[model samples]
Target: MATDSQLATWEVFIQSKPGANYIHAGSVHASDKQMALQNARDTYTRRGEGTSIWAVPTSEIAASNPDDNDMFFDPANDKMYRMPTFYVMPEGAKAI
Candidate 1:
């Protein structure tokens, strides 16, 4: 039931250090999550390119709805104090 291109894609992320941010490494195509993980490891970490790795199937992710854009971003602009424009920079300080 699965075509070659229909084999799921898993996004590969790598964390170089314990506290560093995880970065998108690449993607893998496999029949299932388990296989995807193996493929991701073989394809992405062959040379110790990463200290840590994660493989997430692209379909399993649920993202914000584009239709809710207004409500999603409205509150952030309501509070103006969060901006640094109100205060003057200290003496000898470079322009922010």
Candidate 2:
């Protein structure tokens, strides 16, 4: 019997244009940073859609827990400055 030993997992981000923020494209498995970059490019930018690529180790990314939403994000609801009612839009302005 044979089993596959997967390489390190990398999260791929692609920038569609110069100066644009990188958006998550997909993931790739590679042995190292250089290999990860190559894998990301070939897998995600085949049509030359991306101007830049970022390949970050999946283990290195930090994410917030959804279960702690009230503790983390609800405080903004109590802050008066966050209310749009505090500002008046000009008469000719359209609703955003």
Candidate 3:
């Protein structure tokens, strides 16, 4: 009998252009950072889709709990001034 073990999981982020935001592309499995980067690039940018790539260990990323969405995100709703409705646009100004 043979046993198979998977490599450590890494989270992949890709930027389509310079100065663009790096979005979550997908995940890859590799034993080290360099390998993780190569795997991420090969798997995600096969068609030259990305200009830059970032690979981070899955264990190193901290994410907010989805179950506590109201507790974490609802406070912004109380600040009405943050909304753009209070501002009056000048005549002939294009809508942003």
For model 3, residues 1-96, the per-residue Cα lDDT tens digits are 655368889999999999778999999999999999999988999998899999999999999999999999899989988898877888897735
How many angstroms is residue 28 displaced in model 2 relative to the true structure, after the best TM-score fit? Answer: 0.8
- Runs of candidate 2 with Cα error greater than 4 angstroms are 1-4, 77-80, 83-96
lDDT of 1: 0.82
RMSD of each: 6.0, 5.0, 4.7
Please give me the total number of clashing residue pairs in predicted model 2: 0
lDDT of 3: 0.92
16-94 per-residue lDDT for model 1 (tens digits): 7686778998888988877877898899888887788788988787889988988898788988888888787899976
> Mind sharing the TM-score for model 3?
0.77
Clashing pairs in 3: none
Top candidate by TM-score: 3
> Which is better, 1 or 3, measured by TM-score?
3
Candidate 1 regions exceeding 4 Å error are 1-4, 46-48, 82-96
Backbone clash numbers for all candidates listed:
0, 0, 0
